[model samples]
Target: MNGGLIMKEVTNSDPFTIVGTEQYNMVSKMNREYRIFVSKPSEKPPASGYPVIYLLDGNSIFGTVVEAIRIQSKRPEKTGIVPAIVVGIGYPTEAPFSPHRFYDYTMAQTDQEMPFKPDGKPWPKQGGASEFLSFIEEELKPKIHQTLKVDSNKQTIFGHSLGGLFVLYTLFTSPRSFQSYIAGSPSLHWNERNILAKERSFMARLEREAIHAKLLIGIGELEKEHKSNIGELAKKMSERLSFYKNRGLNVKFIQFEDECHTSVLPPLINKSLRFSLHSQVDQ
Candidate 1:
């Protein structure tokens, strides 16, 4: 099938048969409609609850994610990773899409011009991240939890570029949103604002009550001029880690030496998944 859509029929006697793919259309508080694709493992009975990975830019990465999860499910020994459900959040279009993602993902919006606004319209109208988090906490999470047998404690959020910015934002602003965060080539340069602000603030107010999480910040070593700027970014990220050194949070920063902004995600996803899983197991 196109887009790798696959379906399997199961008999009543077969409890371990693979369930076919399913699609969902959800409307946000803003009345914005989003298409979500969910894929589950081909296993049986106790409806084996699995981990959930919410992927941003789902339309672009959904197929890759599904394949990756399938491969892992089939060869856990080779991948050294556990099979999980991938929740792909898709946008309507690439441009108008920014506002939806920005509103949902950002903690706050400054007076920065959103990249790739074709109409140049005032963007990010609904940027109260708390509301978005509420949607996830009260709505999406509950829906997924009720519909699928998933480990509530094993939720992960994965994003790239601007989406990466949102992932980091959620990590600090809504610390309990997910158990693991994977940010690839985050637009650290967004709005000329430093994510460190949130990091530092969270550090000051951090409490043991916060959900423990694994934070993986990935960057393309070949991004931009490959000069002092990259070094500075890494240094600042390190400082954040230093601040939380004795805290319960687990943070890992990686620089792919040969990857560029556009090319870093594939490798980052693979490495970040393994790292996050390993860290989780260690804990």
Candidate 2:
């Protein structure tokens, strides 16, 4: 995690590359090459430097996120959104998504941990969440901190779907890793809700350590319409939201109307930016 991340400079030759953004490739300790995209605010940084947001599925959404930040943060006084650095963790592939993501975004599992599969098909090679997280904390963050003017205290992580699952996993397992978390349409039903098993430990840890962090979860209105093997995810999401709030966690849940799982991401992205970057984040 600490030593094996080797940064290699990449020239942005792609025609779709966003202006004012830089792309690079880094080899993780697992020897997996990841494409990293970064967009820095043009405005001068504050004394404590700008906040940072680490985005998953960067290849598909980096441009949207960068443009949103640039436009919204241009008039911070009016938008109530401050300038921030955006770090996109993607793969070294021309495709919008990489198959390798199935490994990076899931937790280590066993026969007992995941007793059944909804799809009834074998899952792709997975169980690398711990290593992937180490790549972020030990290899990636330090590199970013050393090279950029970012406020370590104001870090946030954003992910959607499986990546969203990773966001929640990070929060529950290592709450101090970031100040805020944005999970858009997370796959909570994965492996028969195995992720929920960790909730009790997370709550206990929060109480024992008196640690505080903010969470924002968003899902599309039509998510419940599509039936899964387990049940209606929209209801499940609501139930989990209530459970989190009841436990005295700083959390927010939003349901985007007139959208499905994929379509919800755009609005969710806009809201996520505000939720994470706004000065009054605790509210």
Give per-residue CA lDDT, model 2, range 1-283, as digits (tens). 4489877779676566566789999998879999999998888899999999999999999889999989999888888788899999999998989989889998766544443457786667778888999999999999999989999889999999888888988988888899988988887666334577666678666556665578888888788676652225534644654455544456777888988889998899899888889877634
**Candidate 2 Cα misplacement greater than 4 A, ranges:** 1-16, 112-121, 229-248
lDDT of each: 0.70, 0.82
> How close is each model in CA RMSD to the real structure?
7.3, 9.8
Question: Distance from true position, residue 17, model 1, in Å?
Answer: 18
* RMSD (CA, angstroms), candidate 2: 9.8
Q: Mark the 10 consecutive residues where model 2 has the least summed lDDT.
A: 229-238
Clashes of each: 0, 0
Per-residue lDDT over 231-278 for candidate 1, one digit per residue giving the tens place of the 0 to 100 score: 346446755664564566777777888888778877887776676544
